[model samples]
Target: MCKHILNAQVSIRAPCCKQWYDCAECHGESQTHPLAKTAEMAFICKKCKKAFRKNMSEYEESDEYCPHCDNHYVIEAKTPQAIVGVEGEDARVDNRMLKDDRVKQSTNRSLFTINSDDLTDKVG
Candidate 1:
């Protein structure tokens, strides 16, 4: 069981392998090296989907609202989205059989509801 769940609040790009992680703890547990203080950090606003550079002076004093869309960043596990598949196979596929799950890439889109009874806020 993971102590902290990787959610939509923020993500850190590991300096060791340049891979995105939910936090330093995630990086430390998943990676071999420790995260340095000088390493770059970026926060993604769940509402706007815009990345806020942590190193920036402007962002250092910011709060919960996104600077781009002013939408409150929802700090929770996002709903599972429908996975979409690529049209063609990989060129260097040496194996004859391709797994069904491997054929498609999972993508999470924005949380804007077009039409639903669950939607309470109306933006026009």
Candidate 2:
């Protein structure tokens, strides 16, 4: 009798698109998932079940909603970053917060965020 170990296989889902070209992902109109070059954006979506990078066009100026769950990230007004601190608290944290790289968003979270000035990947 041969001892068998069932190796678990993980399935990676490609961003929804028709084309499989490498560069095509960066193309806004090219039908590929674009990546964030600077200033990371991450969020967990209850609907999507996984975090995915999406442009600001997905939020539509609303900072609370997930781009993948809620399309139309761009809006007439700019969305203010969600303030974690409270008013009149001068929100201060210990030095440990800065040094802690371990504090990271989930790997399943999406990172894409749209910028008006950045139509395409600038790093490219």
Candidate 3:
């Protein structure tokens, strides 16, 4: 349940602390020290819950996925954004913030329009 990367498919095992984190930002926030760089990075796949290692030097496009579950772990991180409107707000609270600008459909009908029988008789 990472707030930084909502769609993160794998947890990276920080080489320095040997702790799992969804992203570098998460590691930075939880730990006092900066994330350590390593040529061979370890990752735990969220889908299969398996651990695997990848050598950065020999990394390939196929290495982007988990070897156990074949789940694509490498993807563009989806970060939270600041919205100006009620687009991301909860539905219950949105009513208070949004104005009802939609035009109301008229329910009023003329006598002639309502009495279709009379209009049909006149046309016939």
**Best lDDT goes to which candidate?**
3
Candidate 1 TM-score over all chains jointly = 0.42
Predicted candidate 3 versus true structure: per-residue lDDT over 19-52, tens digit per residue? 9998999999999999989999999999999999
Model 2 residue 98 CA deviation (Å) reads 54
Worst 10-residue lDDT window for candidate 1 reads: 54-63
> What's the TM-score of every candidate structure?
0.42, 0.18, 0.68
Can you tell me which runs of candidate 2 are displaced by over 4 Å?
Answer: 1-38, 54-64, 71-124
Global lDDT of each model? 0.59, 0.38, 0.86
Q: Write the per-residue lDDT of candidate 1 for residues 7-111, one digit (tens) a residue.
A: 455555665677777766778888787886653456666556677755533444345567688766544665446689755666467444554565664353335
Q: Which parts of model 1 are misplaced by more than 4 Å?
A: 1-8, 56-60, 71-124
lDDT of 3 at 60: 93
Model 2: how far is 111 from its true place, Å? 93
Task: Provide the clashing-pair count of each candidate structure.
Answer: 0, 17, 0
